[model samples]
Target: MKHKHAEPLYIKINSIDNVAIVVNNEGLPAGTVFSDGLTLIEHVPQGHKVALHDILQGQPIIRYGEVIGYAMIDIKQGSWINEAVTKMPTAPQLHELPIATNVPEPLEPLDGYTFEGYRNADGSVGTRNLLGITMSVNCVSGVVEHVAKLIERDLLPKYQNVDGVVALTHLYGCGVAIDAPAAIVPIRSIHNLAKNPNFGGEIMVISLGCEKFQPERLLKGTADTIPIKLESVDDIVTLQDEHGFKAMVDHIMRVAERHLIRLNGRQRETVPASELVVGMQCGGSDAFSGVTSNPSVGFASDLLVRCGATVMFSEVTEVRDGIHLLTPRAANQDVGQALIREMQWYDDYLAAGKVDRSANTTPGNKKGGLNNIVEKAMGSIAKSGRSAIVEVLSPGQRPTKRGLIFAATPASDFVCGAQQVVSGITVQVFTTGRGTPYGLAMVPVIKMSSRNIVAEQWFDLIDISAGDIAIGQATIDDIGWRLFKLILAVASGKKPWSDHWGLHNPLAIFNPAPVT
Candidate 1:
């Protein structure tokens, strides 16, 4: 519903905030009047802030009830406030941060929520049944893609219950310092991607056999040492073992067919929402992201926790400035310390590259009214909701406990989504203000819009509209419940907008180690 107003509309997040963002679609021109009697001194773009009271140089600019930045120069009331006039604040110091000091009491448990999912042999549930062909190195990606298409064309039709084939291709496993301490990130990522519950415990590998990361090194030992056991020659197809191109293609097809036959027999069974492992992220963000989409996602995140589901929120740079806010909500001192450790590790990683968190914000972000990383971080952390953070994972490490988890990952959408897939997220929820068409072949991604304009412009791309909250058409709780129910429906095999359109982003591994 279009909200009609006699004058331009603006949104003030907190009573103490000295600035408010213009909510009118076309923005307000100079001398425009607000319902509160505040007149614009200059033209202010939609989603950009306008000063409510005079702000002297060096004084803090408050939003979301927190200091996002400080004034770089004296600002008069009704003046435009933007990135140029706002000096970014320093990140929270890690040492003196509170540990588990303000954990909220758990909400009443939400019982009996269920979805249709495929049960795996490893005691994990899968939201999709498919044959995922893992590549030992990037060299075999072309061959894997070729074989995947062949499987989809020939064998997939015969196996009616199986979804489709995906080549789990990545740019790692060779030509690099594989033994370095940081190499564990990519190594574990590949190992765990093959074991994601969505693949139904079926392990298929396509290898060149000459890569530094040999098939055995990627697979390791069977039994307790391995999460997914590979059985003999049938589980692997090696290009080196093939006499000709046709032989290589034939070998892969035979192996893929074997997995498909097994997968084809599987069927969805009623499962509780507790089996869900959801990953949340936001990209192409703007000022309204914090006010609308992220807070709604946070509320849904809390509901997931109450239902005994595992929820993870990541993007290290996006949450760095707000580390102090998270530490106090940790379930214990150890989790709090773990969070600190990840932050310190990322800080050093950035320093090694001689860049800072400022690199995280894009041109679109600034145009959408996010001044700096400090302001962006505050908005990004809103997805965690009010739940006590139960655990923290380093890059590529899978979660052991089932509640809200802080999975440390870079802010890049592809890398973070890939890392979360390795962490075993069967479904993902992505929020955006400026917008993106990001999706993963391994899981269903539900894209949400933070403003109604984008939602209306790109109607088919976005699956949900938290934009209603920003327009006063819906409350945060309304969208939160709607998202929660949609998650269950999507997990139950209802294709999301991305899936319906076949939009999938390639997997990009996070390799901090050097390439040879």
Candidate 2:
């Protein structure tokens, strides 16, 4: 005989939703029955649920004492709910979560946590040492790369500290709107590159003298900074006037030559692991992502947190689908409230344009069996592990606390990863189910997948394979340990596939207007 278990009671999620989500943790199949005072609703999966009473078409759907969504059609008690009966809802309020401080004692820390890094004059650490051929505008990108390529290959083998010459590329810089933050963008990007502990000593910036991004201003961001020798081809007025192509290339190499220092005198010191800031992200999600990769990342995140390091996760829209389970654990009321604000903002933002936020789900997600953002997010949140959310931070802001930090960012991975860098995440752990070959130009994207096909097909992009978990070959704890080692390796200068393949240009774009 098949065993049965009691269903968890679910209450109305929104004033507008007449229906409630019925959660059954015991793996109940569809069509199982449950009563909610008025009538019975059938059991859905553990993560999915629905109404037990008649719901008006526009009524809010409430669950976990919060509004998860809205009803899309008239519905009767006892009717089943899955992806079909409910609709995503909208809210008007927008703000950050309230700040709080009652955090729990952390779990165990990983043993001997360390990463090999380049020590900089400003006392910052870097994972890679690159010769930077910088440009102030789009027009000089080619010149920057040309200069980088002209350098002799064998000349740098003995310069053990240098990684390679890199050209920072972007599509904007010229034709940018005056009102846009165009002026600040290039400056910030260059400053990040120049100060990034991974860079070995200097930068040679070629400018398009007339663009919105001026060479001199770009110089100031990197101005009077430590370690990096700043070399500016300050004239943008006439390229022919500036030494021409070959001379410019020679100049870039000459700059590179001066900065290559002997690899001696560099030694690893015991920097408190708490100084480590790691970014957590998910992409190309599938059914098993939550079961495997996400939870594993969460475990690793928790381990790092225990060691006093800061672990950050974002894509607020994605995690919005399952905030109830998250809120009670919020270190304080402020964190919970900020989470609510972000959700409401997302709802209003999507509603005003008549576009469903479901539009954010990629085509591959559907093929992988994740039908909606709710299901996708439900799985995504598993990566935070079980730790007190020590703090909630604004975009580009670093975590002031030592435990787990939930940072805010628009839901784009590149944008968030870049923002993570601004937030002080020196390394990022990216999990994908269907698979994507994305890497942030500044922060390293250490890729992993829970599917064998993705791991095998994209071997060049993926660094680890959690697919073994799906086949019952490896436990989540084992994978977490494996990933812990990968993190240390990457942080210590072991190149991830993205770094090895040279896929490093990354940027963060924020929605200037409110999410709406």
| Candidate with best lDDT | 1
Model 1 RMSD in Å is: 1.7
Distance (Å) between predicted and true CA of 349, model 1?
0.3
In model 2, the worst 10-residue window by lDDT is: 222-231
The reply for model 2, stretches above 4 Å from the true place, is 1-86, 89-102, 106-111, 152-155, 178-190, 219-241, 262-272, 323-356, 390-393, 397-402, 422-424, 440-443, 456-461, 468-474, 500-516
List residue ranges in candidate 1 displaced over 4 A.
1-6, 221-227
* CA lDDT, every model vs. true structure: 0.91, 0.64
The local distance difference test score of model 1 is 0.91
For all predicted structures, in order, the TM-scores are 0.98, 0.72
Mind giving the per-residue lDDT tens digits that candidate 2 earns over 361-454? Answer: 7767654545467666767888888998868775544455778888876677777776676566678999997788788756677998966667
Distance from true location, Cα of 266 in model 1, Å? 0.4
lDDT of 1 at 287: 92
Q: Write the per-residue lDDT of candidate 1 for residues 320-430, one digit (tens) a residue.
A: 999999999999999999999999999999999999998899999999999998888888999999999999998888889999999999999999999999889999999
